[model samples]
Target: MRPTVHDIAAAAGVSLATVDRVLNQRPGVRHVTREKVEAAIRELGYIRDVAAANLAKGRTYSLVFILPASDNSFMYGLNAEIRQAILRSPAERTDIRTIEVPAFDPAALVSVLEELSREKPCGIAMVATDAPEVRAIVDRLVRAGFPIVTLVSDLTGSLRHHYAGVDNIAAGRTAARLLGRFLGPRKGEIAVLAGSMLVRDHRERLEGFTSVMAEEFPDLTILPVLEGRDDPEIAHMLVADALSRNAGIIGVYSLGAGNRGLIRALKEKAVDRTLTVIAHELTAHTRAALLDHTIDAILNQDAGHEVRSAVRVLKAKADGLAVIEAQERIRLDIFLKDNLP
Candidate 1:
């Protein structure tokens, strides 16, 4: 039989109310009493039925997801997953809403965050835009006793409780290694297309890519990054211009959204066979590019997994419950032409 609170209270020599406080992670339980209740629960091997308890408590986690308003495959998928979460909201007793801010606009994000802070939702999960103002806002929210989760891109110095994204530095290193090997031992120049340096992910990826390229492949040269702002039109123009200037471009690494623009640029220049390209996200454009040999490899992070991870972290933090760190860690999914689903 499952251990009950009554049993825990009796074992710990505490009142039922005290046991409830300790068991449900409520505040004001003295440290000594919490430890005693915890020990008793451990001795009895008690497993908390969190679902039933939440239902009984009538707890509803109100969370807001701040996403970027970019017309990219990853963002689209992320928004879709949020909608799916909303569909499951009733069953889970969650009130989840999303706010779309302009892509790479730190000021706009800061304004939105400031506005949301007034409402004081249970928690907030956001795609962090790297800027001092944004960091300040995040710190302010944290100081105000809010649980925050950084999604997709993370901020450098902030009080965000968790991050629901890949290790971007490692991802960049991976892309560099793949690009280097795919290009063989031949010396050639590589061009990179990025969303924005204001984004930590893009910056980290560029850092990793350059570090690897400089250390491992000294013969290969990496050109300056072209900021496309996750806009296909901008990416197309920038990449097309880069290709024109550096006709010896043997490889391309797109470490951000805007693959459609890259594809359009490649098509406009008819670069189907010459270049070995690596990009992020396994969207339809990229997948089709892989199938047709436009892109050589793809490094993907599941948007759905990120959304779910953020929800889990926010919900757990809101309830002051410990989460399984290992279970919540998000991974980067790599896809090849031969291994794509």
Candidate 2:
């Protein structure tokens, strides 16, 4: 039979109240007494049933997810997964809410975060805008004892408790290697498309991509990045213009959303030319493009996994529990035409 708190108290030669205080990490328990209880717990091989305890205490984790208000397919999928989590909130004893901030707006995000400092939810997970003011506010909130996690995109130097997203630098390096290897011996400029440099993920991806291209593939040149704002119309126009003006461009690297516009531009403008393209995210547009030979490969991160991991980490931090790092590490996926899933 499993040992109970009463047994633990008896073994440690302490009162039941003392044992309860130690177990709950409440003040007034002397260090020596706490050590005795811990030793007794170890000797009895006691495992805490956190779920039962939370239920008994009527604990409800109030978590907020701050997502970017972008119209991209990946963002849509992420929002859908969060909605699904909300559907399961009742069973999980969680009160989950989402706040959609304007994409890449640091002032708006900082304002929301400051307001949340007053609101003081159990936890907050945000797609950071990678700005100094944003980081400052996040650090202030963390020092004020708010459990914070960065999802999808992370801040440069912040006191965020955890990050729930892919290693974007590694993803970009992988893209560069793939693009270079596919276009072996080709000497032409590569047109790069980005959503914005204000997000850490995009900036880090570009950094990695450029580093690899310069070191390993000296023959290929990366042109000035076109900021499309992740808008399909802007992406279409920018890419169409680039292809029209630059005849020496033989490859494309799209390290952001708006792949639908990129694909359309390739289909219309580069129909007579051969351009090897590598892109991020496995949306419908990118997947179809991969099959049709528009995009050579795709690097993807599971949106569902990221959302679940953020929720789990936030809850763990709020409860003052240790998170399993291995379980929370989001992985990168590479997809080609043959392996579409």
Candidate 3:
């Protein structure tokens, strides 16, 4: 027999009202009491019938996901996940929509956020670039009672309710460890190609990579950053120029989008198989390049996981329910030619 909320309350040694508050994540419950109630729920295997709860509350959440419009593998993956969510919305009883703006443009993102504020969706998920104006816009949305979750990249010091992405700092450290070990004590120059410094993900990745390199692998020198803006043409041109200037470059770390340009530049320089290339995202371009020995490894964040996490957190927030942190955790996936999945 399924346990009732009353049973859960009895098991947790709390009053029925306290149990209700914990389950609904209402104000006035202490952290310790909340934890105790949650532990009891887990131990009892109590599952809240979300559909019944929604019906009882007369809930219909309208959710909007704002993404960057870029011709890159990462953006493509994110778009695919959003489409999947739209297809799955009927079962969850959600009205989900996606909006795309110009990539690497904080003003454009801010404008979209402001527009959404007027329209006032029940929940919002966005990939925020690090800018004071952008943060301010998110703050305004929060004050208006919209539950906001940051996807992929984060906006620090904002009222964002949750972050649905991997530990980027750990991802960076992992990348450095992989690159350093792969190179095997060779003293050589490494180039870092990023989408944009203005984005939090890029900056965090750079920080993590540099920290690992400084602490563990001081033999390799990282060259000045090349901003690709997630554009194939720009990435290709910049990489080619860098290669021409630095003949001893032995490794390349692509922490941004747009592998097309990187592939082209490597092929043009005839260094496709010579240089050890590590990049992010696993798309057709990166997959093919990996098979062809152009790219060595891929550090990827599953777009599906990010999108699903965002939806779950937003829905919970809208319902005034607590999120399951373990269920919503975003994991970093490391892919090589051997294990694609």
Candidate 4:
């Protein structure tokens, strides 16, 4: 039989109410009494029943997750994950709400954060932009005791408690390595497409790609980065322009959303499978592109995994409990055409 709160109270010679107060860290318990209750807890190895405690408290953590309002398949996938989380809210006792802000707008993100701060949700999850004002807003939310988690893109010097995303640097490095090897020591220029330099994920991916290309694939020249803003039309135009200008382009690395444009550009150039293409995110577009030979390899971070991790971490932090770090660690999922999932 597992030990209960009553067992802990009795062992400590403390009242049930006192034990509850001590366990919850509620006010009014003296230091000595709290110490005694804690000692008893240690002696008996008493583990609090999280489910029961939550049920007794009747606490439903209200959580807000801010996502980019982009029409890209990646954002769609992330929104789907958020909807799935909402469906599971009753069982988890979480009131999860999603807010979509304009993509690549630091001011819009900051405004959303400010508004959410006023509403005072138990937790906030944001796909952060690299802006000082945005980081300051997140810091303010953290100081106000809100558990903040950064999803997809992280804000540097923010008070975010956790980051539910993959190591983009590693993902970039992997992409470069794969593309470099796949191109077979070719001496040609590679075009790099990014959503925006303001996004940490994009920046990290670019950094990693640059590092690997410089060290191992010095023969391959990297063209200037094209900011597509994760827009299909923008990506298409930029890629088409680059292809028209750079005939020696043998590889392309897209470290952002909006592969639609990339696909169109490649198809137009009649080099869909000829150039070694590496991209991020495993959406339907990219998946199909990979199958049809538009993209060679994909380095992905599961949007579902990231959303769920943020929720779990937020709930744990809201309840003043420790999170399972290993469980919450996000992994980079590499996909080839043969191993599509």
In lDDT terms, which candidate is top?
2
What's every prediction's RMSD, in angstroms? 2.7, 1.9, 5.5, 1.9
lDDT of 3 by residue, 1-341 (tens): 98889889999999999999998779999999999999999999998877777888877788999988875667777888889999998888889998998877899999999899899898999988778898998998888889999999888899899999988888888899999999997888999999888777888899999899889999999999999988989999999999988887989999988789998898888453378889998888898888888899999988999999999999889767899999899988999999996
Model 4 has a clash total of 0
Among all windows of ten consecutive residues in candidate 4, which has the lowest summed lDDT?
Answer: 267-276
Q: Which tens-of-lDDT digit does each residue in 92-161 have in candidate 1? A: 7899999999978999999999999899999999998888899999999988989999998888778889
Tens-place lDDT per residue, model 4, 144-211, is: 89999999888767778999999989988998899899998679999999998877788899999999
Q: Give me candidate 2's TM-score against the actual structure.
A: 0.93
Worst 10 residues of 1 by lDDT: 264-273
Q: Once superposed on the true structure, which residue ranges of model 2 sit more than 4 Å away at CA?
A: 27-32
On a 0 to 1 TM-score scale, where does candidate 3 land against the true structure?
A: 0.82
Clashes of 3: 0
Q: lDDT score of model 2?
A: 0.92
Clashes of 2: 0
lDDT of 3: 0.89
